[model samples]
Target: MQKNSGKSVLLLFILLIVSTLSAGCTDNSSTSQTIQTSEETSTRTLTDALGRTVEIPESVDYVICSGVGSLRYLTYLEAQDKIIGVERSETTNSASNAKPYSLANPQFSTDYPVFGETRGMDDPEKILSLDPLPEVIIKTYSATGFDPVELQEKTGIPVVIVNTGDLADNKEDLYESLRIIGEVVGKEERAEEVISFFDENIADLKERIADIPEEDKPTCYVGGIGRAGGPQGFQSTEPTYPPFLFTNAINVAYGDMDINVADVSKEKIIEWDPEIIFLDLNTIECGEDRSGLRLLQNDESYRQLQAVQSGNVYGVLPFNQYATNFGSVLADSYFAGKTLYPDKFEDVDLENKTIEIYTFLVCKGDEELGREIYNTMINVYGTPAFAKLDI
Candidate 1:
């Protein structure tokens, strides 16, 4: 009887030991599987706009934009929600906020932190010091003097390069940049929507003006092109101005200089004597009394020009604000077409057109915003000055 009882006790002890070993193995296997899954899901490799291979977070929720137009591109992609910081210029300059992107994303003005010195001038130390450090950094190809690879090495963070090209002539580059940004933020569909919008608008504009004879197109000149906050005088102009190019207007300033934005002599402007003149509203916004309109209103040489004498001088919304407000560019094209050839755009509703553009670009269709933009471009203190003969 004692031996049988001892045998039963030994059998129970062996069963308990087996049970303990099985539980330990199960727990360890679960831990190993969890670790492996985490490792697999944490990161992914992608080719950026510059074609550089980078391993970025699989779920990117935080990023920093570095360069002149990088933030603007991100805004277009509707990924501003992921932006953790901005350049100091974005916070300091109230005028910069006048851009449609800024209007749409007010959080940039109120809540986000400022890290870099300014657009295109990144400070690595400041970037590293950001609390809850960003997951990735996206910079314009020509943004900073520092090497992007070096930056990645120093910070141990993936750096992606995007090219924010001249939107007026480099639509391909813009589309590529948008796609790259979308890929990073997982907004590929949104990027395609933006590209489609651009494509449709440009194609429609081309179709509308395709049959207009070149000789019938009015000779046009744009002045008061702003640079670094100060307005250029009457002679300052863009040779490849998008508004002029897209609307099929004869840009008298085209090929006048080798540079994109150049200042020509007043005599040279008079020599060209374009039939229509577009004044950039930036000078008036600057309040520095350096506007082309101020010169046209004050100077006899400008007043004697045929376009001004004929009341063909028109106001165009500032396009260069915070690196080319693309909405403003398309809007300016419509207004230019209307002013140059009223009969061509007679059926077009300017207010509705502006709202449509703002809606697509900034995702805002607020009537008040559209009205403000319209007023800023066409009216001076409630007086309609677009194409008006008298200054």
Candidate 2:
């Protein structure tokens, strides 16, 4: 029995030594293979939707954005270094109010350098001629107003398309678009993280407001422009587009009107008599700096409306919020929600929202961007009720 025990101990000792040696050899082999693969891994090249087969650095370095919506998504990815240029019109001095605030960090537009404005997308010669060509050009589907394939042939730069425009009906399609941007920017983890955050927060918001009585839901009107000459002050009958429909308020316009937008008379608005009126701030007055309420007050015909009397006129910045584009609409939704339900959303800080939006949608830093966004909001909507509550 003693002899058998000694033999078993020796066998175990030998097996332990063998295992250690095997592990050491495996580690060395893996290290060698990794080094070899790194040397052999060439930069990948692919043909984007634009039909241009462009080569990209194994590490994507620069991205040039052409439209607002695509820029917002790229900023959210935290892939700012990838941005090389942007359309000049995005930086128009007269149209500084155009950038959407809610879903963007200020850095996206203010910090990043602009190449030139995209006056017309069909002129590929202009985009291609810009100094320091970009590795990727992110564009919106409808805004670019050009066939992507043709553009690619002219510029020889790959184009990535992100549908930031809420043209998609539901949230699932929206997330899918995020995933696509993630794949393009090589930030899949960040994309998923952002998508998850949006889902969780939105779900929480729905739950928080779900138990509230329907009777308590605020009656709101949303429209593209403010008409002061109407019998009622400002009409609250805008269609449920990107931002306004996502808010906590009930859309009075959608509920009561069969608006074809072809021939909406001023008298029709007086019939609705909305409690709240939200208008496109940028497009109002044929071009003027005034709130929707002010417009109603200035016009002699609108003295009878409840909205103007109650001071419930809300202004939506058209350059950013009303634009049927990517980040613009998302920002519009965030701002619209907060504006509609200030009491319930008081805790939902815009700063944090701005940062998250910049990270998730704009993919950029959250610096001066917040201030710029706030400024745009103030210009469009007037200072929040809280700002003047002390007075």
Candidate 3:
């Protein structure tokens, strides 16, 4: 009996040893799986306008901007140096007035090679051929050409889509886009700075005119707004134009219209007969005979308008080119404010303000370059811009 018990005990000890070794192996296998998972998955990602969760490097130093306004945003962040190449449209613009972002940084034309056709046709092969091979492609308007996912798969590079939100309705989208670009370019501070600048200035502007009665506000109209197909004469107008919104100017075309834009008949404009009219100089692109300015100069109906006859008409910079010229938008607001309520904005110098916005946004606070771009804008947008139209 004593011998049988000893054998049973020895067998039990053997079974316990096997069970302990199996448990050790199981623990090691689990540890190995955890390590593999850690290697394969990463947490660094950003959600873009398309609602795409895109994985990004911890620090991105090389990038390509695709679609409209992408490059403009990059310029705002002062990250143009990170660009691999530029779009053909940017280089091919034959208009007298250069796009503001390009105007601020002329090197975009001469220094970088053309990446692909403009308006969303990013060529993956061409992108891959660029020196230092862009690590990421930042895009806006993904629906236009190559799909962001397709572009990523073709080039074996990551693509992030963004949105160019307008000042009126989708301002939050605009701010988010800036934040994404800022994070990608490691310029988060700059992104906030730009956002804060907009917020603070917008408040200051609205505050300045807050006390004035709506009935006392000057009746105004803005025309010659640019569209997808280029300049669209005086008929192109925005009811909720930012400049008008900021100063509480009574837009003759406001009340019922498209949320983003609208058109007005010549007869309707005659009916409104706004006390003041501000012409977006983008119409200059359509040539003097066809542009909004020409219509105002030649049309007897427009000539008879009180605002034009009284010389209360003025030229404001174009706020949209590639995508909203943000600096130009704010600049136009000040000009609009100064035009309507000279006493309220009397302390504000129009020329100095434009330069200030340009310097901070594109020139990286370089006042000399800001003034240079300001002069270029004036040269193209005549009536010496930011002043009374000699009409």
| Candidate 3 deviant stretches above 4 angstroms | 1-43, 93-97, 258-262
Residue lDDT tens for model 3, 1-391: 9999999999999999999999999999999999888865643788877888889877788998999889999998999999979888777644533777898777787889888887888888899899999878999998897888989999988898888897778899899999999988899999999899899889989999999987789889999988777776887898878999988989988884533464678888898898999998888778878688889889999999999989988998886686678888999999899888889999998889888888988998899999998888866654567877767
What's the lDDT for all of these models?
0.77, 0.55, 0.86
TM-score for candidate 1, residues paired by index: 0.88
Quote each prediction's TM-score.
0.88, 0.66, 0.87
Clash count per candidate: 1, 24, 0
Runs in model 2 with CA error above 4 Å?
1-58, 95-122, 142-144, 167-173, 224-237, 241-244, 255-257, 261-264, 283-285, 288-291, 315-372, 380-391
Q: Candidate 1, which ten residues in sequence have the lowest lDDT sum?
A: 380-389
For residue 266, give model 3's deviation from the true position in Å.
1.4
- Cα error, candidate 1, residue 79 (Å): 1.6
Which pairs clash in the backbone of model 1? 311-389
Report each candidate's C-alpha RMSD, comma-separated, in the order given.
3.2, 12.3, 7.9
The TM-score, computed over Cα atoms with residue i paired to residue i, of candidate 3 is 0.87
lDDT accuracy of residue 278 in candidate 2: 64
